[model samples]
Structures are given as C-alpha cells and as structure tokens.
Target: MKSTLYLLLQIFVLVIFRSDVFCQEAHKWGGQKDGTFSNPVLPADYSDLDAIRVGDDFYAISSTMQFSPGMVILHSKDLVNWEIAGHVVNDLTKVSPNLDWSSMNSYGRGIWAGSIRYYKNKFWVYFASPDDGFFMSSATDPKGPWEPLHKVWDVSGWDDCCSFCDDDGQLYFIATNFKLDPNNNKKYNIHLFKMSQDGKTLLPNTDSIIHQSPGSEANKLYKINGLYYHFFSEVKAEGRVMMMERSQNIHGPWEIRQLNHVNKTVDREPNQGGLIQLKDGKWWFFTHHGSGDWEGRAASLLPVTWIDGWPMIGEVGKDGIGNMVWSAKAPIAVNKALKIQTDDDFSAVTLRPQWEWNYQPRSDKWSLSARKGFLRLMAFRPLKPDDTVRILLRAGNTITQRSMRTKFNIATVKIDISGMYNGQFAGLTHFSTKSYCMIGIKQDGEDRKLVYSSDSQNLIGVTITGSNVWLRSSWDYQGLNRYFYSLNGKDFLPFGNSTQLTWGSYRGDRVGIFNFNRFATKGYIDLDYFDYQYSKQ
Candidate 1:
C-alpha cells in the first residue's frame, strides 16, 4: 500500500507539471543557450525597417505593402528576439476605397516605408502609400490600440518618410519625392518639409531640397551632439549603398559621404535602415541587405562606431566604409529565444497576433467564433464583373504570415470541405505579388478534386472523397518548393514539380491560407490548424 501511494503521488506531480507547460508552436532562428546570438536575427522578411528604443524596450515597424493591419509593429528587448506587438493600420479600407476586396487592385501599393518614434508620451508611426498619400498613426503604447490613421498629406509621388520632433518643439518631415527631374531625368530627390505642431498637416511652401541623386531614397534624420545628420541610400554602380550628410544646422551647406564596402556580393550592399543607441552608450545600425531573393530582403544588425564625428557601419576599412560581419556578439544581454511570428491552431478567442489578411477582411466572409476551434473562411466572388477568372491572389480574407529562412521548412494546413460549394476553391499557397502557387481542393458541382496551380499552370489531380484533407508546401533555403496532399493526415504524397519562389514588388514571398469562389460567392472552408516545422540544414 505504501509503495502504491508513492507511485500515485509521482504520477500526480508529473501530470501537474505537464499541464503548466506552454505548448504552442514556436521557432527561434539564431537561438543560443549561452547569452549569445547570430545574424538574420529575424529569419523572416522584415524589410524597410525603422526601429526606435524607448527606455528598456525597442519598437520597430516594417513595410507590409497591401497587407491589412498594415505596417507590422514589432517589439524587442535585446534587439535579437522579437514579437508582433500590433499593427499601425487596422482597416486598410480607411486608406483607400480601391483597397477594398471589391476592387482588389492595391496589390503592390498600399503602405510603404514608415518611421516609428516616441515623443511627448505617445508612440508615432508615419508612412506613405504610393497610390493614396502620406498617413500617420499614434498610440500611447507601442503594443497599441492605435488611433485611426490620419491622412497628413493628400499628395502622391513621395515614398520613404520620417518624422522628427526637435528640441525646440519644431516639427519636421523628410521624404523622397518621385517627380521627374528634368536635369537628371529621374525622381530620387530628398526633400524636407515643416509639419504642424498637431502633427496633422504639412506646412505649405515649407518644402526644401536636401539631397538629389539617382535612386536616392530611404531617408532617416538624427540630431546628435549639436550636429544634424541625414542618412539616405543612393544607387551605386554595384548596388544600393548607404549615404550620409551632416551640417551643424538643419538647413545649410551639408557635407556628404558615400558609406560602402568592397565586399559587394557578400553583404548584398548594405543600404536602407536606421540607427539606435543603447543605454550603455553604444550604437548599432539596423540594415536590410538589398540583394533580394524569393524569400525577400533580410534584416541584419551591425555594430556602429563613430570616428571623427561620422558614424561608420560594419568594420571601418582603409576606405572608411564598414565591412559586413557575418557573426558578432549580441549587443545587449537579454538571451531569451523568441520569433516575430509562428503557426496557429485557431484555438483562441481572437486571431493570433502573427496572422493578417491580404486586405481589410470583409467581416461577413470569415469567422473564428463560428467554429469553436477552427478558422472558417467563406468564399467570395471577384471584385469586378468582367473578371471571368477568379484569381486566387486577389481573393479577400486570405490569411498570411512571413515565411522564415531555414535550410528546410514545411507548412501544412488541414482544411475541411464539408461546407464547400460548387466553384469554390480553398488551399494553402506560397504567395508573392508576381507569382503564387496553390495546393488545394476545388469543388465542381458534386465532385471534389485535388488541384495544384502555379503562375504558369493549373493541374487537377484525382478526386478526393473526404470531408477533411491536409495540404502542404515544403521548400529549402534555395526557395524551391513542392506541393503535397495527405488524405489520412499522416500519409502524404508529392503532387507537382518544384516551384522557385520569387520576390515581387517591395515584399517577399508569404505562405497563405485562402478560400475563394471561382464562379460565385457560395461556399466556405474550415481550416483546422496550420503547422510550420523548419530547421537549418
């Protein structure tokens, strides 16, 4: 009896400990055990990044063109591990009526490069849409319930904007203007404008030319040690490289220098990014390597050293430019492993912070509450009456998250087709602006068929007679992906040739869970779960 009681107590303790463990899916790219980390800190595509440190916390915003909950805001403590804090824009329809699902034309042109700053007890985010105009959103907290987006400027042809609040309470705005330069026949001039105290309007006639060069953009401003420094990127013969100009005065004669390294191919030309100063009086540069692939531009954290009052990125060589370092000691000491985003089980009362719709999702079209433990996506028809072929890319309510970098990775989703109607298609996809491939199920009248569709071809496989099916896409670091199907959710079979992922527009490739009607809006599919398993090979 004593022995049996002891065994029962041990079992009870084991059960209690297991119950307390957190078991949601998670992946850390440069995870290390010994208070050290490595490069591509975020293995996903977090491009055109602007980061700001507030007290002990760091906040960053990345460009998410045409994706709803636009301008993904990320938070970090050590600048290596990150989490999805919130989004700047909740409903992109507020930006433009054309962005609605009915129109579906704003694929490559919603929110572009933006700046995030903290001032006067609030966090401010300012960004531009090439088609709409310049906009701003703010919140008392970076993990935000941000204010409704405010249109600061109702003009176009401008991109990559930053906001500055000076010591004397003067407000200023700097951005790249994309007007045809009659002299150079290009539109890469950097311009500065005065902003109102309310942060609502750009003062008329306050525009002044700061720098003009071929492909000059991605501007950032800093005032340090009584010196005004302006940072931007200019297209070089090799690739886009960093450029900086400084003057004692905000407006005056500014001396400029080209900051670059000779290892052009390895570093992919360190160009557009921002700078941050740590509490320990150390500075670091956050940059995106310009050489893009199917996965998109990746972010890098570089050590910054100021020599003779000029900030040098990477390692200062004989040419005064910094060379890229593949591995370096982490700047700060918070060694926890965290990822910006991950997979979903659809078990929460609200959508996971990592998932965002392709556009402002139609409320009536998708639901998480209707199905207690699943995401239900209702098929919607094309926005235009003349669009005879319903394109999967244009479908509203397509849920997506950034695809991370690993030697090998696989994304799988289990979808239920019981509610599917004729002409409805639901699947898992690898998506970008220029190309996309879907591995899913299509309904035709009473028959259900497995199908694989790419940019150039759409092929149908054998009929699947089941209420639920699992679809998957697997790829490697080289961006070659193949589709597969599993009827039992355990046994899987490959379906198609490998498709090379490609970058499109200003964004990288993303994995999406989508449902759409090819003929009419009459069906739906329930996604039981999404699983992402990956590791460096």
Candidate 2:
C-alpha cells in the first residue's frame, strides 16, 4: 500500500507539470512548482546547521568560521527556499585578532557548532569556538542589529553547545568538553549549567555532568509531552550516529537510545542539525552531512515522526531507526524559486551580502566608494609572504563568493587594470583552498601578460593590448574547472589548462577576485561587475 501510494503521488506530480520541467526540477535544488522539493535543499556549503520558525519566516544560521561577520543567518518563507538574513558577529575582531586579515590564521578553526532558540520574546544564539568559549547573541528581529557576542564562558576546549528554556521559566545551557581537564583525564562529557533567564550569564555552582559518550556533541534540548528529550550525536564503534536521551527531570537518571546507525555515504554523514516543531505541530529536522567535500555540509530537511514521545527523523524503519531522506513533500504550500545573490555591479551602498572577504579585511585597503560604481581593491603584500613562492593563497585582499554546484557554472568579472603598478597580480580564480586555479593579468613595465596559476603549476599566457580585460571561470557539477579571458566583453577565449576544484578548510570552492603585489604595495585594480550563472546556458 505504501509503495502504491508513493507511485500515485509521483504520477500526480508528473501530471501537474511537463515531463522535462519535472525532470529538471527533480534534479535541481529548492521548492518545485508542483509542491515537492528536492534534497540537499541547499546544494552549496552551508555547514553546521541550526534552524527555527518565527511566525511565518523560517530562519537558519550556518557556521562561517574564519570569515568576518561571523555566523551566516538565512531567511526563508518555505523551508526549501532560503536567503541571507544577516550575520551574528558583526566585527569578528571583537572575538579575536587571530581571525583578522593581518594575522593570517584560523584556516579551519573558528565558530564550530551551537544552537538557536526563541526565548523570552527574543532570538538567542549560542555557539562554541574551539579556542574560545561559548558566545551568545540575541535580536528581536531575525535580520539586523543583533546584540554583540557576549562571552558566557571563558574556558576553551568546548565544542557543540545548546540552550534550553523550561516551561517554568528556568534556563539551561549544555555543551560538550572533548578536551582534558586539570587532571589530564580524557573527558568527553556533556555539561549542563543553569543560566539566567535574561540570557545574560551562567549561574554559578549549577554545572552538572548530564551525560558522557565517546566523541559526543551536537546537543539539542526540548521539553515535549512532559518529558525532556536531549538530542545529540556520538561516535560509536560503528561511526557517528544520532542519540537521544529522555528523562522526567532535566537532570540525570535518563534512558538513552540510538536514533540512527548508518553512514551509507561515509564522508557525508547526516549527523549535526536543528530540530524544529512547525505551526501545524509537525516536527522537522535540518541536518548537514558531517565531513565536507567541494560541496561542504549542504543542508537537508527531513520529516520527523513522533512515536511514543520519541522524534524519529527521516524515514523511520520497523526497527524504529531512521534513515536519511533525499526528497520529500514541502512543509508548507508556497510557490517561490529561491536563489542566493550572485551578480554584483558594485553599485549598492554596501557590499552585497553574497560577498565576503577571505578574512577580516584590512579596513583601508578596499573601497566601494573610491570609484563611482566599481569595487577598488588596493594591492598589498601578505603579512608573511612565502619567500620561495608568492601564491594567491597568501594574498590578504581576495574578496570571494561561493561557486554553485550545479549542472554548469560560469563566473565572469570585468576588471580595469590601467591603475595597476608593476609586480601586481590581479584576476579571477577558482578560490579553492586545494588544487586551485586562477587566471590573471600580471603587471610588468608597460606590458601586461596573462598568467594562469594553480597549486601545482603557473603558466604565462598572451599579453593583451587593452587595459580592461574580462576573466571568466566555468565549472561543472563534477567540480572540473576551466578558465577563459576576453579583451572584449562579447567574446571569450579559453586561456588556461584544465584544473580541479577542491573544497578545503571546511568550505566550498569560491569564486574570488584577488589582487596583490609581489614587489611593493603600490598597485590596485577596479572590478566593475561580477556576473554568475549555474543553469545550462
């Protein structure tokens, strides 16, 4: 009966749309016109997920470690379609200088995991830094001037953290300490602390060891049906699986169960996420595949079936264990095609939310106002340049955006290099952390040469006659990269050898505009516009 019902649903959807349109929407991301949505709802790298619904708006915050304006928050009308809501930490330098551009550190270690909750009429966010303690922020509106990151704890070695507000108005905080204590004992324990209801501070002498397991983290707490459910993940002998513990009291004497026990795609394990109960009382789970690739930790929505007070995520089996779901019905009835902003003319009052500097950028080096409508990037030497090899990886002024994982992607930028000084490299790059590739114009004495550089090799191409050159980067779903250049905006010439895109540093491959001087910090380039596409064009 189940199989027959599913077949009928499939037929119904195919009849609602043309076969080609249905096929394309099935293969693509986001909400389909026929009221169904594809899996990996967010097909790019939005790591370490946590989501909530405020009224009719669905908000999710993803981990954006090392990048400034830390912790990207996304807004959505339907759970399947999302947009950039805002960021949590406005100036990451307030958290630490190591995340700043000149420091050139924090490659893969910044904001790791945390929780988002609506308590006492405000939105509260709690997150953990591997080097820093738990940080908190709040805002009445999901988008806008969120309270600055307040340090709830000052100790380190703490990973995934969460917040819970009980019905009686008591607040509780939970976090995992995977590091050793003063005694050097291997402590993989989840510690629960009482917090002030105002969301200001942690209460003293209220810390309790609630649970312990090998490689335990990703803690989420909820009070449903007079029973408390503590959701987390633990790395058992079989691998990391979802675990749930329940009790009548917030504290111990708890019964535990493993919610899941498989990693069919071992690297991309469905481990960490947020659990939400919608307006109609139906539950949902938003999760990310654990290990990352070129498409880093993309977000997926799974239905939650409440069985005997237990929330079984994805497709629950007769054994009561749940498996990951690839496609499912939309949580709400809304017809909208959503997209992350990719095209920028540099004409707005501020940089588009889609763009982010490689790190906390040097304030005086980049300007959107220096020119009428172009983004001017001043070339500067890296704080510590490789004496043997001057690679773009070490360049500090690269502004970038994520490269979409689709059937095909084309990113093109128009750059004016007339202001470039000698010994400067300015151009378009794959912006990949590993096995990356870039094609740029090298400034020499009155002669501009096209150079294609990558992690393994750098090739010098033809010197162009024009001062303005157009650079293009094209990639397919397989993550194969190719480069092209054009003297005129109309026709493009393929210029470089083929290279591959790799998602390193827990982020996806990005499309970047890089500028640096190997000799002196005297050159600059103006980028007029950046246009991107992902469909079969």
Candidate 3:
C-alpha cells in the first residue's frame, strides 16, 4: 500500500507541473527530423535581405529603416540558424540631423534595401537612404568593430544598390533610379555606373541604363559561369515576381525571364532577395514573402536549380518556371538552434545586439555604467506640440526590440523610480505607430502613482512609495496584449485593458522601454533588467 501511494503521489506532481506551463510546444521551423525545414527560417520581420556565403559561413544584411543602428548583419553557418552579429551604422545623426531626437521625422525612410558582399577578404555592406544618400561600411569580421560609415554618393531618387568586381579588376555599381510617375508607379530604370576600385567615387559619364520595368528594384549583379546575372524584382498583375537577366558580357542585349510560383500553395509571392551556393554545391534563394501584413515581411529559404544556363527557384514546373519548395532537405547540416537577442540583465559591458533606440539617442541622456548592472535613462522634454498626448512617441531614448511571431510572449522590466522628478513618466511600452500601451510610474507634484496609459488617456492606479517597481506586457502573434505589474518580484497583477497590437508604415510592433519628461528635462530612471519570454501555443 505504501509503494502504491508513493507512485500515485509522483504521478500527481508531474501532472500538476506540466499543467502550469503557459506556452505550447510548436514547430521550430528551422529544421525537422527528416532533414527538411519549413518556410520562413525566421518568423520575425527581416525585410529586404541580401545574403552571401563566405567560405563555410554565411552572412546577411537587412534594412532597419528608422532604427538607430542602420543595417543589421546576421550570421549563420547552415543558413538555417541565424543570430544578430552586428549593425553597420551606429550614428543616425551621420545620416542627417532630421534623424536625431529633435526632429524625429525619419520613420519608414532611413536605410532601405542594402546589399552585402564578401570582397577583398572583407565583408562589404552598401545601403542607400532616400532622405540622405548612398553609404557603405566594411568589416574584416561580421561581428565588428566595423569601420565607420562612408558616404559613397550624395544623391536621392535611387535605392536597392549592389556592388560587383570583375576579373579585369574593373568595378561597377548597379541600382534603380526610382523616379515615380504621376500614378506613383516606379519609373523602373536599372542603372549601371562605373565606380573607383575603392568604391568611393561614382563616375558621372559612366552611367548606363541596364533595364526598365515596373517596380524594378533589389538589383543584384553576379558573374556566374562566365555569364553576368542581373536580378530584379517587379510587381505584376498576379503579384510580385522575381526577374532575372543574363548576358555573356557585362554590357549586352540581356535575356530576361520571370521566375515565379515555385510552390504556390506555400507562398504565392516569395520575391525580392538574393541567391547563393552552399559548400555542398547546392543552390538556394533567400527571399521575403511579398504578402506582408501585421507581422511584416518574413524571411523564407527556397531551393534553387540551374538548367539550360538559367537559374530556377524551387523546382521546375510544367511552364518552365520553378515552384516553391514547402519543405526541402537542409542545404547545410542542422546545427544548434539560434535566435535574435530578447532578454537583458544589464550586466554586460555593452547593450545586447537586439536593442535599438527609436532614434539616435543623445549621448548625455542614457548610460549603462551610471549605476552598476542597470540601464540609466535620463528624461528629456519631448519636442512635440503637446505633451499631454502620445508623448512617448516623440520622446527620445526609447530602447526597443522586435516582437517575434510566436503564440505567447511577455516582456518585463524592473525600473527604479527614485530618480524620477515631477511630471516624469517612465515605463515599459508596446509601441507601434497606430497604437501603444504603457504601464509605469508617473510623478505629479509630490505624489507618485502607478499608472496605465493607452490611446491618449491615463488610468491612475496605486500610489507607490517604493523605489523599485516591475512592469510587464504580454502578447501573442494574434496581437492580443495585456499590461501587468508586480510590487514584489514574484506576484504580477494585470492592470490595463487588453488592447490589440497593430502595425503601421512598413514596420512591425516593438516592445520598448521609455522615459519622458512632460514638465522639464530633469528626471531619470534606472532599469534593473529586462526579461522576454516566448513560446508557441
């Protein structure tokens, strides 16, 4: 009887423990047991990707548009598991003063659709800012110490640039001159220009119009098997389709073909990206699904094949075009799973790779070493017409990270409010251009209150005298979000109404930590740590 009772107790404990797990175990799309992986190697928005293989390692760069650390560089050995290696631009002020805290106007416009190449034994990254100009940066190591940003060309009305070097040591630059017509359709002229071998000066008389098509962008030039392959993305009646032009010579009458619908069932419009060959001599195309919704454009990997001197995406169809491969054997062996950074203890010497400021923060306003093991955020008066509405949107130093497409996610941060001044609000926020919610401490005169604010109104809650407080925001891919707080570290109580997280202006939702001064630039907040947890349901 005793042995039976012990066995029953063990079974009961196991059942109860498993029941407490909030997140469900879902498919980790990178790879599965049969040596195949599903679409979207990454569930988050890694828009406008340019991927290249350097020996056994792979490196990719993506557009981060309004985010401070301009071009984000990602690294992977197997092309399946990826993580943030570093960023190209550290100073948005280098782009322009308008990108700084005072103006806050560079949203959805800063850096767009750059290209990455392994050349001269170094990793070369090139991007163009519509408002600013063209820029380039290089690093011997992808995880830098990258060299400072260099202004390659100071011109506008152009984007989606790529660089190439030929066998004779002649270098060329290819991009699109996106002169919009009256109907707002892209003017669609792909231009080729001669560049200095050092990639600094653009020769004026050397410009050549390579191709013209509607929405012709994301131009990548490659010399494969003695043929110059020029890739372009164009919008069609069906959807966005991948286009490729090839010629035996760099300047030529090129042959163009529309590469579309590799696997129509999986994703009909997997367009606008680069292709590479693996170490095993297998070819693959890294693409972004054209159908971008609230989650933004997610990254997908598809197999590629070369037939009759033409590169085909996925498998060839009856029409001679390739279809999307919903599941294909891993191009490289499945290594350990990796992901972008999300949690922070503020213990490292530098901030985590995932964190990016809304704009380039003022140097005097924030620091990690002001207090040991804490992020010190000093409040500054926002430069908006009114401080009583959407103040956080205009406030600078709003550090943030992207929200992933998982079933369950919670972002929590512990803030010490002893440094807060009157009319100062510091808290954790779910930020988007359309909507936002914040649960944090607000100081008014002599009273300090814990408040939940959303949609231009504040719901004042408990009065707090303690120096430390915990704020949390939880959500899922469906956008159902709730804000919670904890007086102690253990017990959390929900406070705010559940709001649906929304996306806007070519960007996804971001979880952020913010501090703003409504009265004067006089207060500060110390962030003890930030914790992010997620799982699929």
Candidate 4:
C-alpha cells in the first residue's frame, strides 16, 4: 500500500520534475565532484559495517578482525565523502590475551558484527564475538576516547548484536546466537535480552527467542512511528538477503518482510549495514556487499523510500521490493569529493590512522624516533616458527592497510636493508592469511638477493647490490599483480611473474610492511617512505 505522500511524490516527479523517478541506475565515482554519486562509495574493504547519523554528523564503525586498534570508526558529513574518525579499542588484548602480540591466534574470529547508536546523551557501541563473548563501550563523542572495551557477556555464540534504548529509558539487547546440536549442526536463533540502563550488562532472565531461521544475523533494532522494527539478514533461496520484522510489541506476533532488491550492480547482495532517516525526512541505507572477493565488502549507499510505514531501500519496483541503484543523488550535495589519507611517510610521532598492525603490536618491536623520519622495524621471530608456507602470515608486527579496489593500484616502498640479518625476511607484502605474495630483498649471509615470492615460495631470486632499493607492486582492476624492483628509484625492472592477490580470512588483500626472522630476533630495517597511488578508472 502506497502512502498518500508517496503517491504525491511520484506524481510530483512525473509532473513537475518530469523524470521517471524509478529509472534508477547509473555508474561513476561515488562522489563525482558533481551533484551525482555512484555505488560503492568506496572501493576498499569496509565490511560488516554499521552507520548512524547524529544531528548532521554521520559516523560509521566497521569490523576489523584481528587488526590492532580494534574497530575502525569513520566519519562523514554528506554520506559520500568519508574519513577516519578514530578506533574503538587500542589494545585488542582487552578482548583476549590471545589477541596480544605473544599469542596472535585470533584470525577471522576476533570482532564480529556490532551496533552503534546515540542514546542518553552518549555514543554507544555494542558488538559480539562468536568465540569470546559480547562487549560494549560509550563515549561523549564519536571521534573518541571511548570507554575501555567492556565485556558485557563472557558467553560465546552470540554474534551480531545491537542496543536499543526505548522511550521509557529501558535498554534492549538484540542478537543472534549459534547453538550447536548433538549432530554438530548449528541452530540459528535471534534472541532479545533486556539490558541494564547503563549498557553494561544484560539483565538475567530476560532472554527471549524472538525470531529463528537459517543464517539469521546482522541484527539492528529501531523504533519508528510507534512500532518496533527489527532488521537482520538471512540466507534465502535468492541469496543472503536483508530481512525485517515489525510489531507493536517487542515480543510477539511479528510480521516478517524482505529487504533485498534484485541487485543490478556487480554486487551479489549488500546484506549488512544501517539505515537512517535524514533530518529533511529523506532516508538512506549505508551497506556493504556481503560477498568477499579481491575487493572485500565494498560499501554502497542507497536511497530509502517509505511505503505504508515500511522502508524500501534502493530502487522500488512494482512488486514493492527494491532493486540496486547503481547511482544516485548525493545524500548531502557537495561539489568536491572528500577522501582519507593513502600515502604515508612515517614522519609522524605515531602511525597514520589508516594503518593497523596484524594484531596488538609490541611497543619494543617498532619505532618512529629510532630513524628520524623512517619507520624502524626490528625483525622478530615468528610466534609459530613452524608455518613455513606463507611465513609472513605467521609473523607478528606487520603493519598494513587496505588494498583498495581500483582500475589500477601501485604501492611502492623505499627500504634501507643495510641492517638486515641473513635469516630475516623483510620487505613489502600483500598479505592474506590464506595466501600471500612478497617482493623484497632477502639477506643470504652478507649478500642481498632480490626476490619475488608467492605463498612463501621464492618464485624468483637474483643477486642485487643496493643498500637502498625501491620495490613496487602493481595490480590492474582484475588481473594478477606484477612486481618490480629499482636499484635507483627511477628505473623499475620487472622482478617476477605476476601473482594473484588472494582474498581470504574474510578480508581483502592488505598492503603490508613485514619483517620476521626464521632463526632468531636479531635484525632490523628502516623504511624511508611508502607511496601508494591508485586510479579508479
């Protein structure tokens, strides 16, 4: 049933605006520097993300599994141009000591789906781990000195969680739990728990099974127009699809609705994210495509239109469900497209906000002051000195950032290998837990050998004499990556055959500066600078 206002808006578009409002799809940059914008607001891996708009300021938080400085918080004013605001947890060890530099075992398991909401004059964030438990934090500001990660529940199996503060000041917790049966098959159930006023703990005896289905997760709750709406994702015949259930009461006789439209874009289905109603009464959904590929869960913004009290995201067809919108008007119109930092010189007292270590870093292992504008990494032995296949995957203290999807991506790093020890492997890497590729100089006794390695196999090696050498990695929009080396910074020669940037561990490929030793921790290197440049076309 269409609302009168919905009818009037369509009529207005047809009569006055003189355009088929539902003729909805276009392709270009997310922010085209014109009034228009496109899908995939970012070509980077910002997966399983949740976003909210407070006042006129929009903020988002994404899942950063096993990356130190735990959950990345992003800020945007117009919903098109985004920048890093900060991170939630500085030491992931707060979640688990295994997350500490010594253990370093929590891969693809640390932080799962979570929620961010503004409640009671404070910014609230809540998330669950499939293994560890549930956690919560609060702050006066979004770019924050967030309260130290507070473990709300120490019971595992609780996945995506959301917090809702009701009209009467009661806090509610909604999440999905994975229960393994005697057969070892998993049962999925969405549970609602009454949370304490302070958002610190779930009150005992308040857990209620609200909904159950296959693969139900990514929970979010909202109370709009006096009705309670619970949104989530479930595996359907169509694919992983977004879902919603609404009722006048918190628990009982809930009406289920599908939120997925036939995606006309390259995305499989953007099954996770948040929806917001604008101050001007327009609605927008910020989401990430659920499928993981070379580009992991790239984020896209969709316009939402409400019909008969239900929010229809993307292009609404006659059947009433939505279809993907490849391009749309900018949520907040601006002529200039804004972006975050990419190139880092390591001149700052600390790393730039875009960088994260493989896990919680040992302060003694890396430094900025030791080299006076260069990043100095002390080559340390791997925690598990045995995973010889992709040895870089097992090493600690590798600092990295997202390898954004683009028409072309080129990452170059200048290194001073004079202090390198023979047993050490230090250089530039595109590291994924499943597979990794490397192009760096290996120190064999006293000689430096230029090498190109993939999945820990030295695919090619050649003798090189250079204290200061430049290494480059380039990948096209779809092809395998190519590597090169330069004795002088100006002359780049191909190093080895191209290798695919494999995507796994629920993350896309990450550009990393890695250093680890096979024998012992006895070597070090100085990174002069890392220059990363990309083109969307």
The Cα local distance difference test for each model comes to: 0.81, 0.81, 0.82, 0.83
Worst 10 residues of 2 by lDDT: 18-27
- Model 4 error, position 1 (Å): 44
- How far residue 482's Cα lies from its native spot in candidate 2, in Å, is 0.7
Clashing pairs in 2: none
Candidate 3 at residue 512, lDDT?
92
Worst 10 residues of 3 by lDDT: 18-27
Candidate 1: tens digits of C-alpha lDDT, residues 75-139: 88888778898888888888887777767777779888989888878898899888778999889
For 1-537, candidate 3 gives per-residue lDDT tens digits of: 999999999988865653321111233455667777766677667889999998888889989888878788888888877889889999988877887888887777888898998877888888898867889888899888888889999888889999888878777899988886898766979899888988777887999998988888989999998999999888777667888999998887899998765222236367878899887787889887665545566787988878888888877888888876656788877776666678899998888899889988888999988998999999988877285566777888799888776667888899999999998988988877777888889899978998888886779999989989999898865667899998897899999788877676667788899898877989899999999987621
lDDT of 2 by residue, 1-537 (tens): 999999999987775753322222444766666778776777778888888888887888888887766888888877887878778887777767788887857778777788889979999999998887889999998777898779888878888889999998999999899877699876699999999977768899999989998888999898888999899998877678888999999997899887765563432567888888789999888888776667666777888987777888878988998877767889988536556778999998788877777778888999999998999999988765564243666677888887776778899999999899888888997765554678999888778899988766878899877879999998876678899998989899998788767788788887889998887888889999999987621
Q: TM-score for candidate 2, please give it.
A: 0.91
For each candidate in turn, the TM-score is 0.90, 0.91, 0.91, 0.92
Residue 295, candidate 3: how far off, in angstroms?
A: 2.6
Q: Whole-model lDDT, candidate 2?
A: 0.81
Name the top lDDT candidate: 4
Q: State the local distance difference test value for candidate 4.
A: 0.83
**In model 1, which runs have C-alpha deviations exceeding 4 angstroms?**
1-36, 262-264, 384-390
